[model samples]
Target: MSGTGTATGTPTGNESNLESAMQLMIQTFHKYSGNEGDKYTLSRGELKEMLTQELGNYLGNPQDKDAVDKVMGDLDANNDGEVDFTEFIILVGALTVACNDFFQEYHNDDKNDKKGK
Candidate 1:
């Protein structure tokens, strides 16, 4: 998919991987934000649904109300009881960082194994 338009103009598909990722993040946020309440924010139910449908593999047991509540408490930065795009992005950014760390560690382990063999 192509990058999204900035203050300048529509971005072409030839944009960098980071640009495409930014567009995808925007798209994903919108995909789940506007269901029950504010069009730009996610209500608790909407957040739960998004978590279960989009990040089930990573988040696990999204059906667990306690887990969902904990996430909601943590992500509601402004204490508004809802998750805005900025808050949602924080969650995504954190997960991406975690995944990167895991991959780096796994790669290092593989390299060490190869060296030992």
Candidate 2:
């Protein structure tokens, strides 16, 4: 643990992997959040761009036509119509959990396949 940026929330380039990932998440959020009013949050267009660009692997090529709207609706917990940092974190956390579950299941399935063979 580099213990870097413990107070400032800025990455010191010497952080642990987990710390680096956290910084990346914050950086990614700010990147798109600045495109509209309330620089601390994501507008619908910014959210769409971020999803289409950053989450393409999981969200799909063009993604479901309704993915942006649906995701925005779900993530806007306060019904503010824009996703704030906390809401964004919730989305990321949920996706991470889902991905972890999926990979764990996949790994288990592969192990079972080898046993069957």
Candidate 3:
């Protein structure tokens, strides 16, 4: 709706659509870090390397090569390049619209529930 950042710090408009961003991040993370499947945990070096290689298209070419390096440095919670589950969840949650929309798309409510309507 409004292209404004909320008082609680929720970003609206284009910035709020985090699906692409999450997908990009996952793809990039998986690319450099060997996917451990259920056990997949990223190391700092693995995360940093993936960000440089995969996020280039989305994050843009840094004015200086180490620009992204600096960014990733800050985001890495354990000082490891890889973001742990909690950090990743928080980031995605901030970007997602709401829990209703999250489940709505998957449930396809429009096509079903016609037993009542």
Candidate 2 — what's its lDDT? 0.87
Full candidate order by TM-score, most accurate first: 2, 1, 3
Residue 104 of model 3 has an lDDT of 81
Q: Tens digit of lDDT per residue, candidate 3, span 1-116?
A: 24435432334445545544544555544565575433355555554455456545544564344765665565666774566655555534543555558578757865577656
Error of 2 at 92 (Å): 0.6
Ten contiguous residues with the weakest lDDT in model 3: 1-10
lDDT of 1 by residue, 51-110 (tens): 999999989899999999999999999999999999999999898999999999999999
C-alpha displacement of 20 in model 2, angstroms?
0.4
**Per-prediction TM-score:** 0.86, 0.89, 0.36
Sorted on lDDT, best first, the list reads 2, 1, 3
Give the per-residue lDDT digits (tens) of candidate 2, residues 58-108.
Answer: 767525658888999999999998999999999899989999999999999
**Candidate 1 vs. true structure, TM-score:** 0.86
What residue runs in model 3 are displaced by over 4 Å at the alpha carbon?
A: 1-28, 35-39, 62-65, 80-82, 88-117
Off by over 4 Å in 1: 1-12
Candidate 2 clashing pairs, residues 3+ apart or interchain = none
- Clashing pairs for model 3 are 44-80, 44-81
- After superposition, the stretches of candidate 2 with alpha carbons farther than 4 Å from their true spots are 5-8, 61-65
TM-score winner among the candidates?
A: 2
